[model samples]
Target: MADTVSPRPLRRRRMAILVAALAAVTALACWGAYRWAEAEARAALTLNGDLRLGLYASSIRNAVGRYDYLPFLLARDHEVLDLLDAPSDLRRDAVNRRLETANAAAGSAALYVVDRSGLALAASNWADPAQSFIGHTYDFRPYFRQAVETGSGRYFGIGVTTGLPGYFLSHAVRQGETLTGVAVVKIDLEPVQRDWAAGGERVLVTDENGIVFLSSHAEWKYRALRPLPGAVTDRLAQTRQYDRSDLPPLGLHDGPLMENGARLVSLPISGPEASRRAFLMQELALPEFGWTIRFLSDLEPVKAEATGAAILTAMGILLLAAATALGWQRRQTLRLQREARVTLERRVEERTAELLTANRILRDAQEELVQAGKLAALGQMSAALAHEINQPLAAIRTFVASTRLLAERGETAMVRDNLAMIGDLAERMALLSGHLKEFARKGPARVEAVPVARAMDRALALLASRLREEEVQVDRSIPPDARVRGDAVRLEQVFVNLLRNAADAMEGSGDRRLTLTATRNAEGWEIRIRDTGTGIAEAHQFQLFDPFFTTKEVGQGLGLGLSLSYGIVRDFGGTLRAENNPEGGACFVVQLPEAQ
Candidate 1:
């Protein structure tokens, strides 16, 4: 049912397609070669510019270092010291001659000394009366104020005396605690600019305020790289950083940018050359002096190579495009397959992350159980607190009854004293309650040095009534000077818990003695609270300090006391241990490092 075409016409069609492809590929190869040559030329230019900048920066650093050295040397001179001690006119000439000789030897533009009043007392150029700095006041200058206040300073300005732009390095001359005067070395910074100009390279140096003070291009000097704030502009005017010159903003259009180590931003140069001007702008930071150095290279010079590249490359692009089309199609297919697999893997990762988050939630729920245990420990302390307050209240009730009898007898002074005594007892009860509330509070998770005797005294004061009521023989052998590093309140709690346990353990014993002993060894501080009772049974001794393990009757204690105490000690880089003493008592020993 199909019409069969001649084989010769099909062969002719295939030959025509092959010939067209060959022609296209040949054109593409020629275009690629031309473009490659142009890229190589631009790369060479970038490398050459970078090398030149490095050399120039190195030379600038070396020159800048010279200005720093001369002032430090001049400040220490004996003649300069003498002039600062006494700004007498009789000493001025000798100081000037010595300065002039030193200035010439050191290659400084000028060397001068200013008094406390900022008046030039002596100078190296005193021989030329026209250019002499003597008797001229520089109080308006930043260098004068900086040197007096900071002991060293640097400033760039135009000289009022010589009318020359230069950098002034200044140091304070001190005479035993008093600031006497300033020693200054003025150095001309123009030679570097001159060298740059001679090489036909444009460079600019700007201060922290972005005001240009040095430049190879004369028109750029005294211009601001950025818009200056009103206050800064006024300050500069007052200090005369640029003398009477009106500083203007550079007004650069921040558009295209390229970089290697240098950020090349295009700056539009105004005037007749503005239309053809395109410059490569880069900056280097002089962090020590809080200044910036800007470099500019004109792109107009490289236009010839670009033009030639375009003209040569235009002849061959279509051919290369035809030759690479098949390979490009195959590459696109492979990329699509890879992307699909990556998308599937990313979905798996997202699901895995969700699982990990669920596991974290489970871990957090487990943590809630531990916090509940801490709250339960607080609940257990409620009984001890009530017992502590009950004793004080009982005492207060007896005092009140006694006071009523004293009032009826008209023993006015005795009644007053009893009332005062009642007040004291009330205050004591308040302090006890406050201490309990604070002890149970979960605030201020911090630790500090805890003095052993002081903390023990606090605990003993709380338990004093209990001990007397229980007829407990208390033998405390703790030295006043012993100290340990821990949370003071927590350490006090440890002692309170130990004391309460001691009193309870010795309840039925005939001889009830709570002996507290504290001693310092080379490693740390050791404290022992020993209660003379029917000592701990052998079976319970091993689990004495474990959580929820207690020898006392249920509801009498939380079993968390020793467990929490052990944890607190461990957290403070210490240890707590319990053992039945050989001398017939249960002893709780706490070892803590001495406070650093």
Candidate 2:
């Protein structure tokens, strides 16, 4: 009787074993389903977060780039240059008006010009007695120092005068080769942050040092994501980047990394365990601006979804085991299992629809960014391109007027000549328009062996009327073999710019002489255009070739002549420079490499 063991007791022991086995299988199935669902959910969230992060970065970049051209453009203004050249009450008044108007039009927080010594000469806020930046010295500011050192600079910090946080964009203002002053435009980025907050997005932007300067949450501003090094802290202090703001660590703890460089992070709120919240964090780098953007999505929903999936899986497994053990209720168990599967499928379908919506939104954002970029580029090149075509248009106007007179006088030969000249001018205008497109695109210049004398002759012919009007005595001295490796059309433009500048300089001078001399150098042929006028100021000589650097009044030039000429010559493996001649005049030297 096996120690008097009852059959009922044996059956009960067997049933207990079977129940234990089913429970173990159900638990294992639940864990597997939870892990699989969690992984899938994290991957989807990271992908979607990456797209949102990119869109945020694009918006910030576009905002910064939009104002990048403003400082340089304002620096080129004649009134701003005048204020720096000769500081006077009247001139300051003019500049104040100018800056105020420009600031309003540009929608910048403030616009001001600081002399080389960092003294504020004129400001847009001159009217605001409380916030006027006039007479302040900003030499200690890194933005001013950097602009003086480099051609341009950007900085983010609290304003010393206004005590408000803003981004500073500065450009070195030059009259010829001299850095006379700095043109600064202070932009308030609070609006951008406000937009993020309005969207209810958990986003933050950190500088190179990991200190959050902009955020959707106001409490996160000026806080460090991690413990900052001593050196970085010291640098921030020196720059006054945050201006007396305390940068405490956010105590971010990393948990596990997911696909596409996203990861789980736990941040403490206030309490012990209840205060901790998990976030799926994704970061995108704005390399151009040396900034990082983070997008945080709450993980509570994902956890809930994974738990639901696990529960469904566990229930199905238990029902299948029960069905196998109890043959009578097998049909009912199967029906329950099918209903559980249908519920799971419906949830999955809902998730798929959400992902599709996210994808469409991202696509639309990318398209908008592309279109905005295209429009901005067109706007920047429009002014320079217009300047290039204006010269030919003016000449055409004069020729057309003269042709009308000749036709009325029955001078057929002269009229025929004028029509041919008009045709040539039209062709030149077409070529100029095409070249401008290439220049804007930064396409390579057309390289060929170009005759220097012939190019100069064409340039002189184009400016013949201007030279006559100014009563300039032109002299040319070039060897018969004055040929160089260059683009003929571009070289002609360079010559025309130099000659036009020389004539302008000789204006109101007693002795107006334009002398051209060419000589061979070790590198190439050196051509000098000397103008007998009040020679360039010693201060301006160094910046003569810099782009948008001009001494002429506004509307007369866009300060692109020498800069464009320098680039064209460099493209042909040549050099362009300016200096004061020993004999009381300004001289321009263009050297081109010898023909191969």
Candidate 3:
């Protein structure tokens, strides 16, 4: 056995060990908190950066695409074609003035016409005394060569005459099969740069070759994002794309890799000292223009926030350790915790009961609303039923008066015919009443093969007196065998509703014409009812088929005719739509599927 150690020395050694362990744990906790906070902050920054990247991409695309149609449209202008077809000073002057006006209106940098040999025939800047593109020859430009070969081309380069940069859009002008010339529109993209500069975020737009053509920072423009190969540099020089020889690198150094393909990068700020800063870099591609957009988010604020979180975490760990050393105090409050738990349980039960009562009340209110809707629908159906019967009643009165006059003259044949017509009218009224009752019950309509011609004839016969009173000219183009799958009585009711609406629409019109046309399609038959009257209001077009929607005066309609017709057509597996005719008036189309 070893010699006995002193208690004071042993206790002191154990205490020292404990203090070392605590210090290590506290440091580790703080580091973990800092890492977590920095990661969370970077994730948020990446999300926001990606959003800004997309918006910047869209702005660039819209700015460039707005001028895309200019070149193609101007290529077909007669003046441009004439100037290309026959070169003359007189025609050239006329075209130059026309182009100048168009350029100003379109807000393009320049508009010019080039003939087959790539000679500028006329330009928008022909009147510019300093330097005009009128006499400039662009046979060597890639846009001119490409347009001649492929009928159209697009390129971005520095203008040789003006020494200014622009995006060039070209379209080939053709005469019969021969290529005549090319129309070119130059668009200035500096406004887009200015817009980006106004925003707080830093943005850079680069082409396929990694050359930054547009940047929020003017100093970054024309700088290569990466090292350029010999071939790329040669091509750039040949095309005169940048109009600069000393193309410096942006010196963007990659840092740590990030989630979602985002990464950390160090960018050099513009100054004599050339200080560098860390950025969370995100990239988005604009495939339409074969360009890439980069968004840079500063990370200094994120670092500061993480540092503060680390300090708070260190303090929390110290407090947690102290609480652990004093954990025996929790035992003293066990009885009080049990009493509080019981009280909480009782309160929860009371709240649950209250919620159940509220739910029952809500259900009862819902039932009441449903019942109120049913009653309203019944009222609308009653109004629609009366409106349907009034028309036949008027016609019956007219026929009955005619029959009495004929009977006095002893024309038994005419009286018999009038009696038969009255009987038919009475049956029709009864049928309509029955159908309306069925509709109120939400029952389906009877389906069968109904002839379109017969339906039109019956509707027209019913409205003959009204048509005569309104002096309406009826035109029919319905085929004899044109039929559809639907309930005949309901179908006839549809036609009557449509015809009455048309006639009413033409009430005060100088020319009252009702055109009924039916034609066969691949799937079924399309029947159109058109009226030469005041057209439907644009504000009410979409709501025509909605229940209780109407434009008629009081007592004239129940606002249920179109709604009922639309439902009837839908029940037959068909569609009914209304539109304002381009010529005048309104047209209602009913499309029904073909009968097997």
Per-model TM-score on C-alpha atoms: 0.47, 0.56, 0.55
**TM value for model 3:** 0.55
Every candidate's lDDT: 0.72, 0.81, 0.80
Tens-digit per-residue lDDT, 369-460, candidate 2? 23211111221233445656777788889888989999999999999998898898788888877876776566776788888888899789
Ranking by lDDT: 2, 3, 1
- Model 1, position 463, has a per-residue lDDT of 72
Give the per-residue lDDT digits (tens) of candidate 3, residues 358-389.
45654453343222111111212344566578
| Candidate 1 lDDT score at position 203 | 73
Sliding window of 10 residues with minimal summed lDDT for model 3: 371-380
Which digits, one per residue and each the tens of the lDDT, describe model 1 over residues 1-596?
A: 99999999997997789668766765566566545644554455566555555656665666667568767766776777887887676677778876776565456789999988899988989999899998899988999999988999888899978889988889988888888888898887787677666666767788998888877778778888778889998988899877887788875545455646544455556686674356666677877777877777655434444444544343234324433543344466677657645654575566456556544643453343222111111312333355456545766777778799999999999999878877866776776666556655745446677789888886776577678888998898998778888877667767877888889889998999999999888778999999998788888877777644567663455466777677778878888888888989889999999987
Ranking by TM-score: 2, 3, 1
Candidate 1 weakest ten by summed lDDT:
371-380
Q: Residue 21 in model 2: shift from native, Å?
A: 1.3
In candidate 1, residue 481 scores what lDDT? 77
Pairs clashing within candidate 3: none
